[model samples]
Target chain A: MSFTRPDGRGNEDKRPLHIIYERLDRVDGSARFGFGDTKALASVSGPIEVRLAAEQPSKATFDVTVRPLSSLPGTESKALATSLRGLLSPSLILSRNPRTLLQLVVQSLTPSPIESYPPSLAAACINASSLALLNAGSIPMTGVVCAAGVALFRSTTEEDIPALVLDPSESESREAVGCGCFAFLFRTEIAGSQPLPTNDTPGARLVWTNWHVKDGTSDDGELARAQALGLAGAETIWRAIKQSVPQMDNLPPPPLPSRSTAGELGIITQSDEVSDQDMNDAKIEI
Target chain B: MALQTQTGTSTDLNAQIFQRLHPRAYLERFIKEDIRPDGREATEWRDLSVHVGSISTANGSALVRLGDTTVICGVKAEIAEPDLERPKEGFLVPNIDLPALCGPRFKPGPPSEEAQVLSDRLASTITAAGVLPLSALCIHPERAVWVLYVDATCINYDGNVFDAALIAMVAALKNTTLPTATFNEETGRTMCSRKLRKPLPLECLPVSYTFGVFDGTTVLADPAAFEEPLLDTSISIVLDEGGALLSAGQLGIADKDTMSMCVSAAKERLETYGREIYAFLE
Candidate 1:
């Protein structure tokens, strides 16, 4: 049994990713990242005077705030901010500036449905924050953190098997039995020196993962498989980030290729070893 | 001091000092004994109580107590214009306030991040569970409708404000009575008859259960203020009256088995605690 995606993309296909660096003025650094329709604008202002109560002697105080598109920032935004702070903290060397503050603000650019989880928004926020941090160039970072979202769906006929879809759209998410966001850190400076883990690679170090499952009967192995798919999707996003870093200095950031040409542009490449059909299998059967 | 000197035991420490220094370790010692510092079992919940219609001024009101935690919820109804898209539907706005008087951690100011998050969670949960039918609140289409402002105030913050606030909000809504209303076409206003009133129509009752995981195991039900911060992960499950899951959320890392365990435990709670709550309201 096979499941068809609402956006007509394959099970492993991701939405067209768009990134615009330094989109705002007056801020130290800013970036607008979009996963198809879902978008997030993130800005970084760091190493500033720390608040008296939040000051730390050994490391800088890292703060993250998230604002929703239309409504006042609420628990959803606060939860997102906390997740972002935890995911991005490992990549930053906060010890460089002691007793200072590094503040990052993320603003949502799309109307989120009240019912389903916002995995795409989370992925976009993490990616935009990473870009903003890199664009600022003031804070030392261990690596660039890239993220991807994957959702699991099971047909009524084949209740035992659930298919994993990468970068699910809003409508698709409404039908998801479970969904997760996965992030991986990649050191850009030493890209080719070592055989850097690509989409098909098995050993990409995970930075952070969040999973929300609706059905309690779902298998645990499905979560691991969804994460593996997210890792591959994140690698695709990392390649796009690598392409955009070199073009940051130029005015009018380069426009990303459309979804059709993404594969040809090497932004979304599929490995020959693992095919989409193989991933659709219900069980590993090992 | 004299007792310590006489005992001459280096490991001996004051109870308060031990709790203040290594809070996690202090809690872990209790968990190892299969009990909490407050003398509750691992899966045991705090005592819960509910009261309704205490505030005569508001349309409806309820006060709920879960152990030392306390929350009071009041519902106010006002006539307002409806949205263009949904002319027949009214509005249900729910907000939770955690003031400085509740606990020392909160300062007197605008709503803190925690409070805002709690309010948002409450609002979303109520909406997602379809607890009330908005169209039922409409006195007339498009021109005038009853806008319900459901406000929950925390009088004391021991922990698990989510569960207490939600219970209070649901009970208050259930207790609400709306006066008979008439929309006059010529006057362009809605008038209410104070004598004739009807109960707000509630579709279902949704109850939430929150659990905190200690040391990657030992799920603690309804953790107190002292146990909340030290736990690594917290999971919340919302179930309707029919034992159907409305929503499930996890803050930190937890495996699939843990999540399933929490859900099953929540269902069991819904059977016993949920019935007790409804029975009190009746």
Candidate 2:
């Protein structure tokens, strides 16, 4: 008997993909992407004058904002922003545009039910934000980046045979003893002068990796297997994004907001408690 | 940071020697004598100074200085509607601000990750401390309640802002005197007494002690700012005046000795917090 995943897909199968590009007109870039029930929207704006306090003299600043579908934004959102900033900052050549602020806003339109697979939401967010940044075109990039989530789950039929499931849902992640989120970037396309290490290896350069293993389960040989499996999953995602481009529609010009720019800020739509003062750089330090 | 830990000598020209000896060697030598770099014993703490009722404009305020680290706390009490879910319970909002004046790493914009973490920790700590019971804060149950917005600002950043913030907040809360509220039966509204005469009821005080571990085992209590980033592991333990462990934050897997040493250090310093606050109020 064969073991099937919660979503009824094969161990190596990806969820049905849906990516909407440049959803907004005026913003430099915007994208809405989903992997099954989990969905997120991302928008990129600027290379513009940053607020007085956050301005840097030699390099551009990255202001990453993440919004959830419900409840107040707290440490979790801040953590997401921090993680996303760390992941994306490396892929971007920020020195090109000095003394400017690039705002990256991500909104989780639907919450994934799989609590154990928290990285899946981040994977989707990372892909959506990267897609939006690409669409915006204003922000300089060194390489094309995409991320995928993978986990090891026990089969219902044999219990002992754990399957390495790609694009694991929250339910599948909870059942899996080990899980990982991996991101990749095409090396030849990015930066200058650092030649691809070798001809066979020019395939995919690892950009980011975050892995986890459930407690009580020892790490005998599963970590290496998870890493290889995650890298393969990331390669698959990178291929899909590359192939989808030829079939994708050309991005239309961004539309301008009818009202004042401040009224349309990402901050206003974030949470109920935030006021106009919050939009005008009210200190988060407090 | 790497230079301070070298024990074996002299080949590297850039290596920093502590008193002509390696830093790790200095630490090991001091440990035998039970002393530390700053001239204090392993369990000894730096000097602490507290000044209450310093900000006249605020309902209550205090400034706390723990060694070189400084924090000023202000409490503003105002009447506000109670939450629908828990109409009888009042609200308490504690925010910790880190301005540029505090350090070079922090900017003047929205709260950084450190500030947010500190703010959330202090808020929960204050609630857990049970310093102001919700029932007493309610002027009229389900109608209006006194909301205390406690804000702590770090003016100088040396080390251990969390402990200093909580201490300043405690001092400020003790110094606070609320105006007596009377229910006007005719108007069916609560009226505030012109003179601030009533004091909020006290519950329990929670004090936190932070320690840093070198390599992975040696526990150094009350680490200075420069020593924090270099630590392999660190732990902060919070205990109430009753000696119950309320909460703790730790990085990396801590050793058994580290936990025991931190708890004993916390217990030893618990009384000093109360004694100093009592002396200040008097």
Candidate 3:
């Protein structure tokens, strides 16, 4: 059989990402994030009075609800709510708005026909909700946290070794026996350090994860590799998110870093030293 | 605590009641004495009884009681156009109802997660078993065919509801009689004659056996969900009379030996109670 992804993208490549920041005026904050054909829009409304039944005693209550692309909500949607709520609870600097409620709604626009059975739209949901929460600007976060989706791919060769794919398209995700979603925080770096998302930032945290593979299958090695790739992909998206926000034109640029570590790390920023090769790497990686 | 009216979670309120009511610890103690609390061997099945053709309105109906669990399955057959993709085949739809009457845990609303899972499992098992040849229900090529709707309701919740549902479904299908249908070319409709009933083509018997691993090593046959819902491992296996595996569902990592033991026991049940389970159909 011919070795070709259904979307004709490389196994290691992520789908084209498009982010529409502050897309809705009515909501406190809103955004639309799309990875290939799967699109999700999220809106945040909160710092409002908490209902007695749903109140939190100490911290602001974070509620995440996912409405699927088609059909009424089912067990899968309920499960997604649980996972999203868990992730947002720790990420959302809720201590600032104690005795309040933060409601986030993520609406998936398309169902995955590519991964036909028991489809999941987790990656899209997380990204859109994160963007909306940031746009809301109601709560101060310690760091910018984002999520990335990764899948394990096997080659067509006689010896099929698993390869990791970041932000896999629906069809590419279909080929993966196992996949996971990873969330990480991008913390501010030292003036001349590695990059904005160096591997060991004090605040760089993994806030959420959901990973699974076929039962009784020996895919532990594959899962570990996929998780590592997922973290890298999350960093790439974190950089892209920072770049997407309208930059500070008035503030003086930080003194050109004594060393060009950002250029070598494939990050595109206000720094004028970004090389074409670095730009290409940034484009393809994110 | 009252055995019949006593509901779940209310047990939490009645702590002293649970001490006397639940024999789980007592059962474990009995195992040390080389006996089950119910006075049976580890592999011994609970007493089961089946009554077929009990519902007057349904074409086929059966009520099954295993130990304390009770399930009633009713199969209704109607003439309908066959699907375009499988014109020669009919259809079978299985739905399981977990109503509040069965227990306090189930609420009155849409189908619960447990119900949906059981419905899908029973449907897949029926399809894998080839319980009825779709071609046998065809009338006038693709114009009309018999569609069987098998619905099971849990009236009592003692335990092993899946086993009771599967047995009731098989019994109900066996009791079902196909009505005579003649296709008319003029109206493109089927005319049915209920009096001229005929038996459906049932070639093989598909049965399920459930086993639960208690305390990791001790395995109990037909374990009750009420007493021990969480276990180290729980497996349900469905097999046909031909010794071919039909369908299987497992919750946890069951040891290799435990799986094989359950399979061997299920095969034996296919010959013993599996065949005797249909005695009421005649």
* Model 3: CA > 4 A from native: A1-286, B1-37, B279-282
Q: Write the per-residue lDDT of candidate 3 for residues A1-286, one digit (tens) a residue.
A: 2345666767556666666553354677877676666678789988888898878778888877778777776555655665567566545678888789988888777774311212225777777888888888887775666777776555657466556667766665555655556666555545575553332434455555444332213322443465467667676666556654542221334543333543333322332334335544533533
Each model's lDDT:
0.79, 0.68, 0.67
Query: For every model in order, what is the number of clashing pairs?
Result: 1, 12, 0
- Candidate number with the higher DockQ (1 or 2): 1
TM-score of every model versus the real structure: 0.76, 0.51, 0.53
Better of 2 and 3 by DockQ: 3
Candidate 2 regions off by >4 Å?
A: A1-72, A75-286, B1-35, B183-189, B271-282
**Local accuracy of candidate 2 as per-residue lDDT tens digits, A15-110:** 766555634756788876667766688999989889988988889999999887776567657656765786677578899888899999998876
Candidate 1's TM-score? 0.76
Error of 2 at A11 (Å): 34
